[model samples]
Target: MTQIQPASFRDAPFREAQFMPVTLDVERRNDGTVILRSRVELGEYEPNLAQAFTKTAERCGAKPALAVRNSDENWEYTSYADLKHSVDAATQWLIDNVPRGGVMVMMISNGLTAATMTFAAYAAGVILCPVSTTFGLTGGDHVRLRHVLAKTRPDVIVLESNPKLAAAVVSCAGDDVAIITTDTQTVNRRAFSLSSVLATTPTSAVVKAIANIDPENTVSYMLTSGSTGLPKIVPQSMAATAACGQQALVAIGRAADWGGVIVDWLPWHHAAGASVLRSTLLQGGTLYVDDGKPLPGLFDQTIRNLREIPIAYFSNVPLGYSMLVEAMEQDPLLRRTFFSKMRLMLYGGAGLQQHVFDRLQEFAVAETGYRIHMTTGYGMTETVTGCMVIHYPTEQVGIGLPTPGLEVKLVPQDARFAVRLRGPNVMRGYLDEPEKNMEVFDEEGFYRTGDLAVFSDANNPEKGLVFAGRQSEEFKLSNGTWVYGGSLRAALLEALDPLVSEVVLCDDDREFLTLLAWPTAHASDQPLGTIVNRLRDFNRTQQGASAIIRRVALLDQPPNVDAQEISDKGTINRRAVIDGRHEIVSRLYAAEPDDGIGIV
Candidate 1:
């Protein structure tokens, strides 16, 4: 077995941190473009696997599945017949190439091969594992690539031939592992060209064989964003992904077949991206694959795409919404179509900026005359999809009440903590590491979500959960009134009212609460008096155990990347935040109590 170290993967793209988890398969990814040169045996779930596949395929057949925008957006589609045929050919291809489930590692951009391989792997019975091209794009991604490869022990590595990654892939590959190039025009070292075979393969008999496999067996392996550690190789049961779509449909107050067209790009490696694709395919929904990156250039293009297509729903990160609100406010026709037929506008990945929320609310009042459903969907790759979703018309940023059939328990995050979830969607445990697996679920088997939250209304239990920050953000003070950093952070976000991007609460057990804010663009250049007045107003109506910002320091840096302060996934390491502002923190405490004349 080969192992990759932290140093080799140190400066990886997407995340900059130490790598963890040793995947058994290291070489190839299941890019759906290949013909499986293997067997299609019904290892298990023989009873209902065909039925579920039929149902899922039938759903896909009703609508044309359009993936990748611009050039690769093949409006051309395959019916249930075609999907089955493609699956069959791909399965046969896998068997012919590397039978008996040798891992096919896929490290490519988000496009057809990355998308289609998901179904083909299930058809071929090969272990389908995909890695983020983050390493190739940014270089340091090998830390995760190494970790995933080591743990998974893949036999064949399939990669896109990009000039930048050519040297790195060769340098990083382990011996005996085959490297295949897809659509990139170069083939070497047991390499197979993807497009060449797709044009010639016969899939009729292959799809017939795949009918025997069970739905519960591992279909594909997805990795997390690895904000905390290395990206974990998360497996989803075929049943779980399908069920998640059913639950998400219910959460959105729409029929399973409600004219859904998903618009947003959240990266395919994580839960949000994969689930959106699944949800659309299962519901016969059209997916407008947005080229937006949540940053200005990409997201602006998304808005343009939305206007062209009759998008039924839009989902993205907090930054995306903030930028989108600016776009909506700028255009009148865009605003009309934005709210029209738009049943769900979902936010996940990270916290929604309060400013974005306010602008959305304001936009609803002006454009549609009624507020549309604004929601927060929550889950990890381990759960296969979001276990909870904030329902529409529910104000504030909530992860929403638990989806039907899911159970949630408030595990004490810190002394003042309250957030955890468990259910059918919970993962079937990690790849290995029993000790670590044991920590994920409790005595009752609820998945321990490390988030902190407040009951939306202390009076109303069923409303939803309001996310505070992470538990470690809690800071105690001389007063012993444990400042709930999560609650304080929420209050700061609430207090700023649609002003800041994301809030990081500062409490070192100090005398008062200080805020390290990542400001929203619209609120960027506002006057100091206006900001001070806003905080003072917030303090007026503030209540117990929550925070009242004594002072707010707007941090100019983007979300901590390079894992120096925050990881690539945007989870602020509280330690990084506090230490980075040591001197400022000291001064805040020294002047906490009436700076002039001790309250004279």
Candidate 2:
């Protein structure tokens, strides 16, 4: 094992005394490149994912590491010792059943079995690939799943015992690859039970395999949903993933000695879930897998979990926090329990609205007697999880300074700057696509992030970068003003809170912005007259042409996965919105708009 270096928190990126006790060191090269790196040292380790779990297990021992609700709707706990034991057992099973250095594609949901299996694969040096369980045989999800299977060409696939997922994997895997299911009973004779594998005794061969594994080996092939094309497989090294975990711990200002708890439902298919799991495990913290999502009829499950367990750190998309705010308003007991032991509230995937941010702060202060620290970060699968995170309190939305190992360069494009990042956290390149890789990186090898951003304080890089929308999504109006879709969408979501669920900003060669919005489930109960009146009140405060919505078209159906409007991670694909629904957009500009189109 390599001796871990001590992190230097003295030179943190932000104003040291204002926020979390974390800092970074920024240096400028003579070649006009600025480099930002984390000052916090990651203490000694073997720089392997499996080694991380082994050390955490020894330290945490009998402490609870994971919690999941059983079929009976009760919490079942897994201690660190139990986790290590299970991982070892499962590791031996993989060694026996799978060829060395094979791919282990996971198609299971968030649970004890799924979590253990993923770690066990890493321990045995299998490349872990997780696919969203929501992906079906049809739609854009199917296209993504197929792309993943073709790229990784997995040696084995793990999934729930259900027929739906079984069929999906089988269709993608064909007859060559082995299928492992969680069911005890065999519905498909070819499918092996995951329990049978877990029952295998530990072998020295597995131990030897773990010792021989290389930190530079690709540990995972995380799929990224390209905004313009099919999902791309990111070959992530063991060292990169582990480094990301350390960065996460530093970004949150978490002490190794003070282990915390997290309640999360984000899918393992995405980088966010993997980052959270790795960070919690490395910090010896507990993770309670909440099955609830931000979508309608699902957030209640999250509320139920929160009502029972006190979370120290909370992470979610802006939409999830919005739903949570609505729930907290209705239930006083929930408000108290949710914020009882809260340390930090983190939002990602997109910029949060000012209204939603303010509401959460109010609730936290009322319940916890003070305003809790609310922060956000910016990164993608290419960066493992986050390259830049806000470590301190900010007045508005700004992704905080770069962590210890990353280098962020801002290249001028349009009115804003396109963010280019390079570090251990970033992937080496896209799998098997040399041309695509060339297009994404510059002459200096910084990965070109398609998104644009602006520094919050031009004089002070420590203040961080404000996300300016995706480059492809931005379009010019007839008046020649470029409208940033991401910022506009966030503003509309805030102003139309509790009424609009999602918004797609459409304008190119048009006089003003056209909003194609999906009403909240609650909005379905209100009359069209009521909905239009609410928009009228929201528009009254707006000043500029870029901010004004000349026509509002209420969508009868949500963005469809088949049409490519909804990505596999459930985020709206902005280009798909305009291209998929050209008819709806055209109607908004008709001489006499339809009843569904409200003229402002």
Candidate 3:
């Protein structure tokens, strides 16, 4: 067993930024329940998302509101004024067609048009439901798409002009639902062109619709990842969405200055991506909709985009940061362009490995003589994005304290605490699911997050909290030893660095633990003996049965997005993968293991 060194960022200069002062109000109940809230009052925020966009448009009409890569591989910019006009026209069309408060399902990818339609739908008082394009594009059966359609019962379905999507929509959507495409050519009888919608003359009705928007009214029906079961629809209100942005502002301050540039590829269907979109627009910043992703084939486009566009703020999942680190390590020009103007680097969706954080700091120090401030936040679809953030400067990874206007309740659960939240940003309940609503909230009206956390410094309440794992994912073995899946996964990832890209723990009700891992790209070139030796080293350091890995199997295939084994945000659906790949799990726990299984 070897001693692991603690991360030290003292020598590295942290990039300067305006962070709002944090003052937490902590209350310890007689029953050992702890309540945490920020004392710094949340200032005024926009009443509705429509008003926010309108205000930004008026403030910076000539500034680029959104940009997308054209077919020629050059960015096509859309000014705030131009986008406002388009949104007004689209709003007028929606007022004429769809009933007020009707749902409009968006199945389109991120682009200037998608951005326009999103705000237009908000301004027109139409509840927007943005779903993953993979639902319609991939998975031959379109099971999830049909399920979403059934749940939403949308009046209009808007998507990019693709024959496959058109066919899928026609098959799943009701005949009464109108289908809109970007192009003028319609593939189905009920289809309409986005061009026609945008060509509609803006009347006083559009202005009136925008003015009539209520902060309490539902703005969007955000869908959960459905990792454990079917995707649940979370109805986000205008006030909640706006409050999320204000929370970020008061907690971590602005990611960039006014009119700053942001390049991102996070899908708009997810809460984090939606927050990024809304926050950027509200702050009067330019958002360049990135077409690239963190996947192997698509990440190259991300590198290309970063090379061309100097971003003020960058955010991605841990895996995405891992890929970026590899790219930046190889290309000096890429590092220069990426770090030249980047004020902050934020990671979410998963725990970032300490090695990745260390390497990024080294690169940052080399590039600009200052380590870019890296932070993370904790939230979900129900919260309209991150309601808790790592606002202050610190080297360690943590979930941080609750943002202003949010209350966090921590109930004792073994050594950790089960997290529950109550905030203006938090959702009232899942859409029309009274049974689930009852189960999700407690008697005090706190939204039960089902997440486990421990204080970073129990003696100091301001140090924030560290995520332990999900309560549902924690399972007891046959021997009655509980395995904290989330914390264990994070630890194993750090221990097997540069070897495994991701790992899933198994043997929930069995005697011991096993792992199914996806190898890193470089790991494939390494000898099997080397990977086995690393696992043996990690196992030797563990003292308890819960922490020990008895065997490991390298997965040949990645988590399939079409099968719902992985989410658009790159989060692995642990239950989905385990259920979907029973055979693989069985092989890992066989009585007489094969040569491929690395026994420790």
Q: Estimate each model's TM-score.
A: 0.77, 0.88, 0.96
**Candidate 3: misplaced stretches above 4 Å?**
1-10, 183-186, 478-480, 521-525
lDDT of 2 by residue, 462-522 (tens): 7777887877777788999877767777777877776777888876789888788887656
Residue 316 lDDT in model 3? 88
User: 1-600 in candidate 3: lDDT tens per residue?
Assistant: 121233343476788876767688999999899999999999987767897789899999999999888899888899999999999999999999999899999988998778988999999999999998888888478888898899999999888788777778889999899888875354565777888988999999988888899989999999998887768999999988888888887777565553588898889989989887888888898999888888778889999999888887888888899899889777888988998987888888888877678877777777777878888889999999988988888878899899999999999988889999999989999988999899999999999999999999999979899998988788999999889889889889988887887889996788999888888866878866677787778888888999888888888887887777778888888878888899888888889988888887
Q: Where is model 1 more than 4 Å wrong at Cα?
A: 1-63, 71-87, 99-102, 183-188, 203-205, 253-259, 351-355, 411-417, 472-483, 505-515, 527-557, 560-600
Models ranked on lDDT: 3, 2, 1
Q: Could you tell me the lDDT of residue 294 within candidate 2? A: 73
Best by TM-score: 3
Superior by lDDT: candidate 1 or candidate 2: 2
> How many angstroms is residue 48 displaced in model 2 relative to the true structure, after the best TM-score fit?
1.2
Clashing pairs in 3: none
Better of 1 and 2 by TM-score: 2
Q: Which candidate is the best by lDDT?
A: 3
Q: Candidate 1's C-alpha lDDT?
A: 0.60
RMSD in Å for all candidates: 13.3, 6.8, 2.9
